[model samples]
Target chain A: MDDSQLKRRFAEWEQEYSKRPARACETLSGVSLKPVYTPLDLPDADYLRDLGLPGQYPFTRGIHPDMYRGRLWTMRQFAGFGSARDTNARYKFLLGHGETGLSVAFDFPTLYGRDSDDARARGEVGKCGVAISSLDDMATLFEGIPLDKVSTSMTINGPAAVIWAFYIAAAELQGVKPEVLRGTIQNDILKEYIAQKSWLFPPEPSMRVITDIMRFASEQVPRWNTISISGYHIREAGSTAAQELAFTLKDGLTYVEAGIAAGLDVDGFAPRLSYFFNSHLDFFEEVAKFRAARRIWAREMRETFKAKDPRSWLLRFHTQTAGCSLTAQQPENNIARTGFQALAAVLGGTQSLHTNSMDETWALPTEKAVLIALRTQQLIAEETGAASVADPLGGSWYVEALTDELERQAREYFRKIDALGGMVRAIEHGFPQREIADASYRHQRAVEEGRRTVVGVNRYQLEGEKLEIPLLRIDPEVEKSQCERLSELRRRRDGARVEQVLTDLREACAGTDNVMPLVLDAARARATLGEICQAMKDVFGEYVEPPMF
Target chain B: MAKRLRILVAKPGLDGHDRGAKIVARGLRDAGFEVIYTGLHQTPEMIAEAALQEDVDAVGLSILSGAHMTLFPDVVRLLGEKGAGDILVFGGGIIPDEDKQTLEGLGVGRLFGPGTEIREIVEYLRDRFSDRVAEETGD
Candidate 1:
């Protein structure tokens, strides 16, 4: 139990494990794992100052003291596919399955601001997620679900402002006030440049649009989270855990600076600013990454912005299990992988969690697959007793050491980004892209060289294994039906009103006027996604990526 | 003198997800292949015109929109009408095994799924291109 005895036991255990040579013990970030850790490893650590009580300074433990005891983290299953009617049915199905919240995944057309009837959207009307080209589709997508009661998160960028305006206008149609609407827009365009590559305008105008939303949301949508600055897609694009943390926080800093420059007080909008992260297979590293994120964010918000509100300093985030980690070979093993990942998110004090389905390596998750995925989170929350205590590994020597090391690495990245004139410059200069490429290359090398063992990929050689899991197949007819719906929508809406609203939207974009209200007006007029986006494009112009990436 | 093998890498449909297409474009370029990527949300017509204007030896269509069953065959059929069917046609995405087989049967040169090593695709194209040239020259 004492330090010397623990160290002696660790030495003997390491020697034994080294002799076996079968199971390699290491962090997913390539950090070596020792058999045991002691106080000597973390000497200058102040528990209260560094890893304080929940809701205290630095707030590494948690943002809330009674994290899940009062109310469990929302089991928000990200669901949407096909026409609005189909996605609406899926939403009700998920809600019936005990899902706590709704997360919308729009199809490519909606994400890229193309109407279902557009030539560019021909075969992709409702393929990946739901297709919402007009207010009619938005109204149908949330038909039975009450906008005021249930929280919704829309996974959209590029056309995030227009999509969010549609949601707000739809909420108003349902008699819900903007101040009472609660959810997230994922309006972080900066991350789209870093990893997702779904950007619309150039960086300067994009940040301007983002800041305008931040300011408008602060004034109107008090309960809504304006921007969920995401590191999830970045990590999914093959970034290491530290890169996910550092790059995501750098994005947060960029948004903060933009918001401050827009003449808003930091404390006014900072509390509603949330984060979305990837919970990969590396349990300890993931936990440490989350803790370090909170510590770094709290310190920056307080020291840099001189914020007086404690609420403004907290970094509340939602965690989703990494979709890229699922293996198509021996897909059942993904269940265990997701279980452990869910455990990590819970232990990391995620405010909400979504465990990816096992069959996602193939297609959109099926009903059976998503139910099991939801059960994975439920099992950890109810059976594992992890939710009993906040920050269960707060005092562990290994966790503390890992957290400190991760913070150091992340701050080094922060310093590098700062020297390169922040995240936008760094992205344009291909710094983050090159870093991610190098990390992805290192991971691929490890898997090939047997330095890291993927369960069924390299070490576990099960050749010609047949997957027993049922794959989800989208009906080809869904596209045809969605196309028909778009045709009917175009036929029904008043053409003159739509044209006038789009003209106003274009003129608003051409001036100093905020585009959010104009976008909302366009949504209300049932202007198609392509029409609205083209209006803005005529003013802001489309982005041409520099010869960097 | 060896002529450059120009290829138009297009991401047709509304799929804003371009990680795979971007990576493959980069990989092909690094493998000494000239690649002109007509960014996301390109129509099949736009892609065909671009391929014609670029005078590409091949056109690689990348669509993850689950629309490849209809989209891939359209591209091949359009290329045929435009008298460009001799250009090698290939595609990649989350296509089902059965669908890939169907696409291949319908004259698609190759169908790549996830976890495909970049080298394998590059080598296949190299050998196939030379074989086609040899047949044409009666060598």
Candidate 2:
């Protein structure tokens, strides 16, 4: 049966189907869903052009041919809270529980480039994540964990370069070579201005800092992924899957262009660039988004950027189950939600995954909840047969159609972004922010109007459900100990050496020299995170966001 | 004529999570209130100064970083020091059930936890402010 015969059969089926009353249906992104999908739905989709063989160009099926069969996706849980020592214990615990990689979540002060003792950092020290103030803290945080053995992903931006320098210096203390360092820095700052709102400097200077890391890492730490261009935060902030994909890829393109402008070879740095995406509850939609992301990145890298290496074209990403979808009511239900979402990520061929713990909506996850979250991934890998085949849902009529539709929508967004002169300009004009706000508001209204049903939120209401899950509470003593440690370090460190290195860092920031070396020196000299950031702040100044809806 | 209700939405301390705060701010604005949003990394002093300068009738502190124990009371105290003691202070974000009672006992108005409806917050403000106006006018 060729195209015409399939089309005739589809028309006959639709005629009969249309006679019956249709039920209202749509995806999470408001894309209208059909009662059924057929091959005729994707008549123009060329198999060879649109989705080539896995491990080939335009890798929509999967990046590697064998995908999970060759090696399972890393069970990298995002863990960090309280002081460095406390988080190190958590890291060792996760590793002992069969976790493969480490993903660090920094506290608010660390994320914003403030020391634990900064007045603004009071009460927030080690609250959301580990507070790493200097090389001393970084060394202790990774204490016994060999940098050469475990691949680490640090989720920090704005001050990513500085934090990364601390990591490099700490690795030096461990006698690990820079070239052996394998991990990612969630160093994508464009997403900061667009969604996460953790930005430190203005866009122009931030881009410069990112490009400098690209240049330095390409030479020194070839195995390290300098930037994890992220859509996880965008989706968490309420954008649809298509918006997250297009905006994130557009940000990647912006970084690629910046690298080229800074005189780096496309293939040299592009291969080390990675992505981070959110795996939400809409399983098929999330899978489709991942497939479309690969196709877009592959084509853009090979054609648009004229990259020669196949590694440069691969769209490797780390996925985390959606945190926003978790509910504070009937919290146990979130375990099922995270399991299904993690399965979607596995089927979508994520290189790494972080399953959200069930109790996250109220507080950080307790030991039991985080273990359940990690076990969710382990079940999908070990028990479920989903990982046996690459792109298990590939070639399904509904999935292929959804994948094509998502790519079409993302391409339309790319055109609009290009017309607006690119992502930075679009963000400055409040394009992505307004888009997310509108989508979020629409979804909220739907939930309120009973048009959509979240399992325990608006529908299937449980009256006066008692909270029973154990919640992780960071001790206020964590803050006190951290501040005391920071103060003691200040008193014991060579103050004059810190000042001299900081002046050098300030000079490096003032000029065109790559600031990584100077920052590494500052870290080595025991210059605190805040002191090094202050040097850059003195030169670059702080960014104040303009008002937007 | 009744004065238009002005509210200041502030995120105190070092938390960068602002999705809830932004959503509440927009919700209040859509409900016809003038909202001044103090962006991320705001200290208690900054929040209190913003509330005093904006002359808001209410100040809503959105903190998700579990620092509500320290930050919320500090903001309330600063508001008093700035002679804005009459300004209604409420809070939201990840505050536990036990802590909610403690915060309210410390003169913080009703604290909304996760899964709270924006309309409920809007309604709470409407009732509280109208009661204040009636009592002051000796209705």
Candidate 3:
């Protein structure tokens, strides 16, 4: 471990590898990976000072002392698509398959707060995920599933409040008290404008709505994660590994500032705040990214925000296998890719994980496909024994080096964003957009030029490969079924109550009052998603992007 | 003049994932074609109207949800009813191969899936447009 011996070993390994030649030495984020590392590299590194034991300051190893030993990570298989009944069945199936938690993926119409029968929602009902237009649909979606037992994470952004209102109402109908209802609402609309492009209101108003939910949830749903600041979609949108880490942290910081500005203590709501990360193909990079993310968030939380509570400093996250990486060509190969990605998630110390199905590239995952995906995680947990050890790669020289490098690169991005006046300002200036576009372009060029091999894509030219895997096909009647349901709900609901709730929602939008309570009231009254959003639109107005270079 | 090979890049539904659409739009533009990107959440009527107003040579509808069967044919039928039948209507998404064939038979030109290169869409559009032009000129 001495400096001289470390140098000798590094040189010796360099000589040995020089003869063999490296397959690759570059991180996915383009950081150059040195062949070896030793004590010399960490001369200034204080192991006790830098990486204290888990659950301590600068908690790089993990948030908890005994991570998986205390309790295994939540296996939340993301489901929803088709009629509420169909999606409900899928949820039950996943739960039966040993899934510990539920992550609901809403269809496009529901995501945008549209009813299935809306002109804009024509062919989209139950397409990508379930169509929950009202509390009726939400109730149907969670029909038999006990609300208090299983935690749900709804992947909704623009209309997060409205959709969450429906969820709260549905839970209330099930006799689950607001305090007992556990789940997360991906109410991070800032990221929607930044990457996902799913914004209903402009950023300023959107932030206000999000802050209100944070304010409310801190008191009501104490166990619920108010906003899961997601880097998964950012990574899926073609960001580099470093970009994902940096942008995600930057976003997390923005939310903290927003919460503070909203007259809430930093530690009050910060403990419940969570993150969602993407587990991409590069195994080491993903692990390093996760480690660096924890280190940066913990340090910033304590030093910058002065968060007193240890729980406030912890960066708990949910990890999903990279969907963009799944290829329709050689569909079965996605299984291996998903397995490795899931393994990276486990090694990275994700609090929860969702492994993407092989046929996800074509449509919503078939049951068989989803079973394989879930089994991928089960195998990693039981057979691989990866869960037995906490941060198994923590002491490895290469992993530590990569982690340090990732932190440095991400800090650089953070500094750049800070210079540009934080995340919102940077988004306004289109800095993140341009960076991702350039990164996406570079990655595509690399694939085309054969610098990076995507198996069946850039390499392994399988001519006329017949896809053997069975792809999930949504019953075309699902759309009709959804439309019929929407039609019936409209006819059955009391027209007078719907109008009254819509008026109240519009009035709240026009005033400084918290609209989420009004949203919940509307959901309880069976006001559809489209109606509630339309009420808000009458006051807040719609979004139109300005053309720029 | 052979009419500037106009194409409409329309996001037909609520799926806001537009990276692929934007990339394809930029690709078509770079390939010497005029692409009218109708941003996000356009109804079938709006799409048909935009195509007619832009006088596009083709309409490229992008829908990621499994709603192409209902949405795609709606646009196709609306285009026909609106007297915009000559325009080639093509699209892409997470569509099953069987549905792709079905949509193509209903006058959709081509269905592009994930990993479908923009270069391929560009080449096909060019060849098909040129052939149409040639047939019109009796060449």
Fnat per candidate = 0.42, 0.54, 0.63
User: How do the residues A244-361 of candidate 2 rate in per-residue lDDT, one tens digit apiece?
Assistant: 9989999999999999999999999999999999999898999999999999999999999999999999999999999988888899999999999999999898999999999998
lDDT of 3 by residue, A425-461 (tens): 8988888877886787677657756687788876785
Task: Show the colliding residue pairs in model 1.
Answer: none
Ranking by TM-score: 2, 3, 1
Candidate 1 residues A113-195, lDDT tens each?
88887777777777788889888789899998999999999998889888888888888889988888999999888888778
Q: Residue A480 of candidate 1: its Cα lDDT?
A: 80
Question: What does the lDDT read for residue A212 in candidate 1?
Answer: 79
Candidate 3 ranges with C-alpha deviation above 4 Å? A8-24, A546-549, B1-5, B131-139
Model 3 lDDT, residue A178, Cα: 90
Full ranking by lDDT: 2, 3, 1
Lowest-lDDT window of 10 residues in candidate 3 chain B? B130-139
Tell me the deviation in Å of residue A151 in model 1. 0.5
lDDT per model, in order?
A: 0.85, 0.90, 0.86
DockQ ranking, best first: 2, 3, 1
Taking all chains together, each candidate's TM-score versus the true structure is 0.92, 0.98, 0.94
Candidate RMSDs in Å, in order, are 3.1, 1.5, 2.5
Q: In model 1, where do residues sit more than 4 Å from their true spots?
A: A1-26, A33-35, A546-549, B1-10, B22-39, B49-58, B126-139
Candidate 2 Cα deviation (angstroms), residue A283: 0.9
